[model samples]
Target: MKGLLVLLICMLTATSVFAGKADTVKLRQHLIAITGTSQPRNHQHTAALDEVATYIKKEFEKLQGQVQEQVYTVAGKEYRNIILSMGPADAPRLIVGAHYDVCGDQPGADDNASGVAGLLELARLLHNHRLPFRIDLVAYTLEEPPYFRTEHMGSYVHARSLKEQQAEVKGMISLEMIGNFKDEKGTQRYPLAPMKLFYGSRGNYIAVVQRFGNGSFGRSFLRNYKNNANIPVKSLRAPAFVTGVDFSDHLNYWHFGFDALMITDTSFYRNSNYHQPTDTIYTLDFRRMARVVDAVYTSILNL
Candidate 1:
């Protein structure tokens, strides 16, 4: 009995170590450094964008993974989307993306810096781990407005190229504004009156949102992530015409008939600092963000 107890303890400790939390401090610092400054529109912070991309590339290369850059010029301004691939590159691929750009004078910590933080952490967690299918981790630019719904959307460019080349993409997951959580009631809001009945008022749960036709993939992804992370998750499927439905970079992939979902905190619905200067790193819930990243890692592996 004593030996059996010791073995169980060891196993539990190993599991805990493997499922350790994402580095909140590192994530916070990354966001603070980028959005803390005035990354103005049309004059976007090119230096900061390059810095974050370099950091991601170095981290992935440290694990002996292959990293590539896809560069495109938008309105005479050059921008590059960083891509990191693990496992067999020729196999069916799952693309995970988050835009690393900010809009206006706001430090877009929750607006999108949080999403980038999650993406970087996800890449770190799955760095050395092998998977059955190829995973392409991307950091896109120009997800914010003025370019959001237009053809200038960075995701639109990337996804369109994939379609043009006939790349076999199995599915895509977009991480957007996923670092904030609140356990208090009356903290969450919805676009439609009926949605309030389906979801709770507390802002503690992560949301899996999709359009009407994409509900099946949304539910399946939500179920898998819920089972893996054991974290609170809220799901909603509605027509894209609804307000705040096409709020993330994922909407671009959906335009191309790809099965995609947005993992978010509902952005402006719950986060008070959505597009303001107050969207700093201090306001984010890093613990939950780490769990979400872990769940994503597991979901991709299973897919």
Candidate 2:
């Protein structure tokens, strides 16, 4: 009987590890596919954006997700937002979004390929789960400048459509930049000086950035995400006036009074490669990135 109990314990442990594991190999492949296009995946490069969108659509198709294209035009040119929906169609929704467009002519590996890769991986990981509610994994385009805070932004269009349909959106989380990290002291910086005292000076943790009065959905998501996260998870709930608070696609959701937040490595705060040609795949830490995706996956399940 004791021998059988030991065997059961070993089996349980193995299952636990396997269940929690995020496939780093798959993450790397997604990143390479996203960042390796012939031209930079920027607003100016419509064909390159379409290439990335095709890749993302194929990936979602592999999981048999109900994929659709949110097509919109900007200044006579066209763009697309690739959406993959899972779970009951009528159920209230949870949104996880990332922009695929990069700034200027850079690989944008960490700038946003990291986030898009996370979105794709989450779709793969969540495909097998019997989720009780709808989850939308969106790959938005034109999130980069010239469209950043405008109605033309892909996220803005998506949020507006959800509002028009009166879709029950529980909350939204934007994966901005999740691949940058550092162990050295003073490597992290903040918009304000006092923030250093609370958040520390290490860029090794993931952050959840929300506006004040983030609503019930945002609160619950933070609690669940923190509980499930394996790496150090830090969160900041501040007014939008605070720099870096409303800098991503989540801001569009918030504009419609939806509970929203951003999960990031604090872009431009710790990552010197932000918007630079140096923002290549070589600078990313895929293992930790997988952890970020793992935590997000578990958190979504619990939510």
lDDT of 2 by residue, 1-303 (tens): 999999999999889755766888998999999999999999888999999999999999999569999999888998999999999999999999999999999999998999999999888888877778898999999999988999989999999999999999999999999998898899899999999999999899999999999899888888998999889999899999999999999999999978999999999999999999999889998888999999998888788
In model 1, pairs of residues that clash are: none
Q: Global lDDT of each model? A: 0.79, 0.92
Candidate maximizing TM-score: 2
lDDT of 1 at 47: 67
TM-score of each: 0.90, 0.95
Per-residue lDDT tens digits for candidate 1, residues 189-252, read 9987667787978899888888888735566677788788757887777788889777888888
Question: Which parts of model 1 have CA positions greater than 4 angstroms off?
Answer: 1-13, 36-43, 215-217
* Quality of model 2 by C-alpha lDDT: 0.92
- The candidate maximizing lDDT is 2
